[model samples]
Target: MGFIIKLLLTGAAAMLAAYVLPGVSIDGFLTALILALVLAVLNAIVRPILVFLTIPVTILTLGLFLLVINAVIILLADYLIAGFAVDGFIWALLFSLVLSVITAILDMIF
Candidate 1:
């Protein structure tokens, strides 16, 4: 199904981020897959609420605040997932950015 493809792509992106970013660590492909699934769920359920709550600041920052939201989501995932780790806020931000870019590229390619 399409969802499975997306999940695999997201896992690939997470693994790619782990490879490129020193501060982002994923224990293995299975951990990356789990992280991807958790991130998808959080983004679907929690992200919209956070985005709605931060609308004022998000508008003031001209949408850049979404990066912070993404980072927070990553941090939350790191906290919940034992095999996934983000060193700090900066690392989370970078990992989120890299993951986004990689996923976007994969989406486009496939």
Candidate 2:
């Protein structure tokens, strides 16, 4: 199914991103898959509420605040998932950005 394929791509991207960034680490592909699922759930449930609440700041920053929200989601994932860790906020931000890029490329290819 398309959803399963996307999840697999996200897991692959997470693995690649963790490999590329010293500050990010994943135990294995299984853990990467778990991470991908957790991220998707958080993005679906938590992200919209955060975005709505932060609209004023988001507008003031010209949408840059979304990056912070993304990092927060990553940090939350780090907290919720075992075998996955991000060193700090900066690392979370970088990891999120790298993961996005890798996922986009994978999506394009597949």
Candidate 3:
């Protein structure tokens, strides 16, 4: 299924992020898979509400508030998944950006 493939790509992206970014850490492939699944689920269920609630601020900030929204979600993923961690809010933000772009790229390529 496309959804499962996306999750796998996301897990791969997380692994790549851990290798590329000092601020991100993963215990192993299992943790990467768990983190990816948590992130995807949270993004599906919680992200919509958060986005709607922050719409005014997001609009006011000229859509830049999306960066903060992303950081929060990454932080959530870090908290929910054992053996996977982001160093701080800044790290979470950076990880989210890198992970998202990498996942998109990998999905397109493979």
**Top TM-score model:** 2
The reply for model 3, stretches above 4 Å from the true place, is: none
**Candidate 1, run of 10 with poorest lDDT:** 16-25
- For candidate 3, what is the lDDT? 0.90
TM-score of each: 0.98, 0.99, 0.96
Q: How many clashes in each candidate?
A: 0, 0, 0
Residue 6 local lDDT, model 2: 95
Model 1 lDDT tens row, 1-110: 99999999999999998999999899999999999899999999999999999999999999999999999999999999999989999999999999999999999999
When 2 and 3 are scored with TM-score, the better candidate is: 2
lDDT digits (tens) for residues 1-110 of candidate 2? 99999999999999999999999999999999999999999999999999999999999999999999999999999999999999999999999999999999999999
Candidate 1 vs 2: which has more lDDT: 2
Give one digit per residue, the lDDT tens place, for model 3 in 12-77: 899999999998999998889898889888989989999999999999999999999989999998
RMSD of each: 0.6, 0.4, 0.8
Report the lDDT of model 1 for residue 57.
100
- Output the worst ten-in-a-row residue range by lDDT, candidate 3: 2-11
Error of 2 at 2 (Å): 0.4
